[model samples]
Target: MSAFPAQPLYLVANGPLAGRVSVPGDKSISHRAIMFASLAVGESRIEGLLEGEDVLATVAAMRAMGADVARGGDGVWRVHGVGVGGLLQPQTALDMGNSGTSTRLLMGLVASHAITATFVGDASLSKRPMARVTDPLARVGASFTTAPGGRLPLTMHGACPAIPLEYVLPVASAQVKSAVLLAGLNTPGITRVIEPIPTRDHSERMLRGFGADLTVEESARGRVISIRGEAELKPQHIIVPGDPSSAAFWMVAASIVPGSDIVIANVLMNPTRTGLLTALRMMGASIDEIDRRDVGGEDVADLHVRHASLSGIEIPADLAPSMIDEYPVLFVAAAFASGRTVARGAHELRVKESDRIAAMAAALGACGVACTEHEDGLAIEGTDGDPIPGGATIATHLDHRIAMSMAVVGLHARAPVVIDDAAPIATSYPGFVAQAVLLGAEAR
Candidate 1:
């Protein structure tokens, strides 16, 4: 999706990694911060906002829709909102780049307004299904014209005084849930979503932070989440914590590399997003939580990780929703464990930037790690903490997680690991290479 030329990278066995570092801001929260700020009544200041390409797409879309968004030289981003039901029709189609989150959530926002806008994306994002979000929005009186198979490159027409509906999630997806809730922000009455399985609560937390009328109730069926329509939003100063997804690479890298000890600062400790930590600790990783505190509305802590001999464990299927994005790196971690690691209940990985399970299997196998690809997940055979044969160049499939995951493998491998293209890392973690190098990874 990036216009930059393919950038290949090589990583070899590095010495003991030791450093104290912080990753970029939470990508999920960063997207919401801009969206909510743009809908509030006054100026909202944001600190530690992620400036990655994906988040920038959200900013660009908001600006095109009449939100005054600007970044101060002092590193704080300020947004002047246009108020509820006040979005201006954009002059051009919204280019979402490779960010599915931006496209899906923005579609929800536009679905309840009186605006008609077209949404387009790069090749990778265009292949993803948009029907999941559009189906729920259509019940709210919005109409959509999408590519065959409900893919991207679509046009949506919003409904004024949109119909309020109660819908149940067929799957556990934060994106779909957020889209429906966002549409409810401007509808005429209460819109309700019954989530059979809980997903990330960033949208609900952020909506409440912006003073929207929202509530969650536990019932016999599931968690019933409701948002009142035509609500007024008030702006507030927000400080985003470091992304745990980004920190996962460091967590896995330090655990396997011999004698490696590093401290990752200000990582988000949201319960719904810490499955990787739980899985790694179950594998005998020495990760300690130090100085736990609250930042904005989420839990933040520094992770003190040290080298430990890891053993493969049967990862719980219920944990899939919490660490779905981190599975690629988790596979790399599993490769160094003492036995076989089995993962299932992650069919969602098939729809990410690439088929992560298949992509990781091929990449790891190319590096001489034994792996079996499954319809829904993967099973990897570990080298018992020994160096794996890694003299092969891996195809990244334009997936950032796969690129970074193999980079971790190279650190403990017998030979250098070559990435065909690392450019996709800029979508979320632009400083990934430099940050790894700072932690003693030999990269070029």
Candidate 2:
């Protein structure tokens, strides 16, 4: 979380984990906070913002586009926007680092303004599917010159007074949904998105909170979201909760490792992001929610989890969108369950920072766990609460989730699991190793 991480992390086989830990602010919400606040009319103050590299990329991009973004000594971020449709063309290319959320979301913001900007990213991000957003934005009059395969290192020419169109999401992706909606912030009239599957609703909620005219109507087809543009965005004070996605690693590690009990504090309990919790509960993990409250209009809770025997079952595909980012850790949990765990309807995993299914599958198999990878998901044969025979070095491919998930595997492995290039963990969970060590795990 400090700067670029150069040292590779080493997480060894450790004793039982106990006590409490709190992760950083929600990555998704942190990106949105800096973005939404930058687009509002007045100075917006955000508390508990995530300092991870991914979200920080959003902060830098917003600042590059002529927004005054600054962090105080007290750790709150303040942003003064040029209002909707007032963003200036950047003088240089926006370096998105390794964040898909920052790239896709900022692409939407730039698409509706009368500006020209270029987006570039790290190697992993350059291979991601940007067409999901670019394709929809093209219909709204934005023009793009992308790298081969519709990848990054692309330039975009924004369309002033862009045409409003109704878009239907072909996939369950929050980034795509948010990109379209963020573009609608400037275009005149109502822009609608018809989602066949519900993704996260953070953008819609924050848009409305910032005083944008956005409405949602649910029908059999899916959720119908309409946004009216050429509107003023009012600044707000936002208190972001802990990222549920980040909390997922500990949730799985505690539940699967023997004699482990831990409490994670101030976690975002939004229904959409709690899919991992629900799925774990269905798998028979002993997780309890306490200190329930509301923070910044989103549900917040403290999770107290104790180790329990888990039985694998068919993971409901509908929960995929909610727990998309948590799948790698969940797959680790599945590796130690009672029976075969089937995770289908998650083809999206193939396109993340790395092919998550393949990454986890290979890592689990390396650790002596039997896992079969499907095109869409994976089927893992659990050891049924047994320690895995580790002593394998996993290739993390510069992916934070892949590195952390395998680190969890190391906790209960008979031998130490050495992660290749654990530097990627700084992308999201910056202090992951320190926290793991604090929880009585041998992580470096």
Q: Kindly list the per-residue Cα lDDT of model 1 for residues 1-444, writing each as its tens digit.
A: 557688999775458899998999999999999999999989999999999989999999999999999999999999999999999999999999889999999999999999999999888888888888999999999999999989889999999989887999998899999999999999988999999888888999999999999999999878999999999999989999999999999999999999999999999999989999999999999999999999888999999999999999899988988998999999999999999999878999999988898999999999999999998788999999999999999998888889999988899988889999988889999999999889987787
Screening candidate 1 with a backbone cut-off below 3 angstroms (N, C-alpha, C), the clashing residue pairs are none
Task: Give a tens-digit lDDT track for model 2, residues 265-364.
Answer: 9999999899999999999999999999999889999999999999999999999989999999999999889999998888899999999988888888
lDDT of 2 at 295: 95
Superposed Cα deviation of residue 250, candidate 2 (Å): 0.5
Off by over 4 Å in 1: none
- Score each candidate by Cα lDDT: 0.93, 0.91
Give me the displacement of residue 326 in model 1, in angstroms.
Answer: 0.5
lDDT of 1 at 14: 54
- Spell out the clash pairs found in candidate 2: none
